[model samples]
Target: MFNQLISFLDKGKIRKIARSHRAERYVKKFSTYNHVVVMLFTVFEGYHSIREIVLGLLANAHKLQHLGINYVVKRSTLSEANERRISTVFEEIYQDVYNRHQRAFSGQPFKQ
Candidate 1:
């Protein structure tokens, strides 16, 4: 189910956006893609805190592999990524998705 929902996201486009924003600069193990995946997981699972998000991911480690999440995200890692990464990258992605599906949403084409 999670995998299916993430299928709507274009990984190539995500990487492109990350590059444009330099979101991966100085990054080590955690990439922008991983960050995005972890955030989506947190929201979908209704995790109220960073501790719960970490534990939840750790608990479902085996299942998350199919989602391309290989390592368990540490609380610090998630917190730091949320702070350092440019929020505009996500805004651009959201706008892209919204524009692409705006007609379906409003029954009319989106205006620029």
Candidate 2:
């Protein structure tokens, strides 16, 4: 179910935007995909801190690959990425996803 939900994300589009933004220049292991997944996972699980997210992800590290997150993230790595990476890539992805999915929720409870 979770995998199917995440499958809706256009990874090609997200990666192209991330490349344009140079979001993965320094990190070899942590790609934009991993970063976004960790963030979305944090939001979905309601993790309040990077430490909590990292710990939770680590505990479920083996399952990350199934969700298309190829690597286990470290707290320091997530912190560095958050501090240095431009947010526009994710913003663009978010807009794209919302635009694509908005129609599916037409009768659902949402402003749009």
Candidate 3:
């Protein structure tokens, strides 16, 4: 299920955006895509802390491989990425995603 949802994301587009934002500059193992994946996992699972996200990923390390996650992220790595990465990269990605899917949402009515 998670893998299917992740498939909706275009990895190339993500890398292109990251490049434009220089989000991957000076990065070694952890790339912008990896950070995005980890953050999404954290949100979907309702994880409350860096420690929980790390441990959760660690526990599901085997399954994550199918999702293109080659390794278990450390708490410090996640923390550092969150602190240093440009927020605009994510904002642009969100806008692109919304634009691509806007037609599906066009007919829906919203309630205040």
Q: Candidate 3 regions off by >4 Å?
A: 104-112
For every candidate structure, what is the RMSD over all alpha carbons to the true structure, in angstroms?
Answer: 2.3, 2.4, 2.9
Q: Mind giving the per-residue lDDT tens digits that candidate 2 earns over 1-112?
A: 6576687788898888788888878987888877887888898889999899988998888998788877677788889999888878888778778777887655764443
Per-candidate count of clashing residue pairs (backbone under 3 Å): 0, 0, 0
Across 23-109, the per-residue lDDT of candidate 3 in tens digits comes to 888778888888888888988899999999999998898898888788998888788888889899998776776666666556664
Taken over the whole model, the C-alpha lDDT of each candidate is 0.84, 0.82, 0.82
Collision pairs in model 2: none
Best by lDDT: 1
- Worst lDDT 10-window in candidate 2: 103-112
* Higher-ranked by lDDT: 1 or 2: 1
Estimate the TM-score of every prediction: 0.86, 0.85, 0.88
RMSD of 2: 2.4
lDDT (Cα, tens digit) per residue for candidate 1, span 1-112: 7887677677788889899999988889888888888888888999999999999998999887888888998888889988999899888776776766665565666556
Weakest ten-residue segment in model 1 by summed lDDT: 103-112
Worst 10 residues of 3 by lDDT: 103-112
lDDT of 2 at 110: 43
Clashing pairs in 3: none
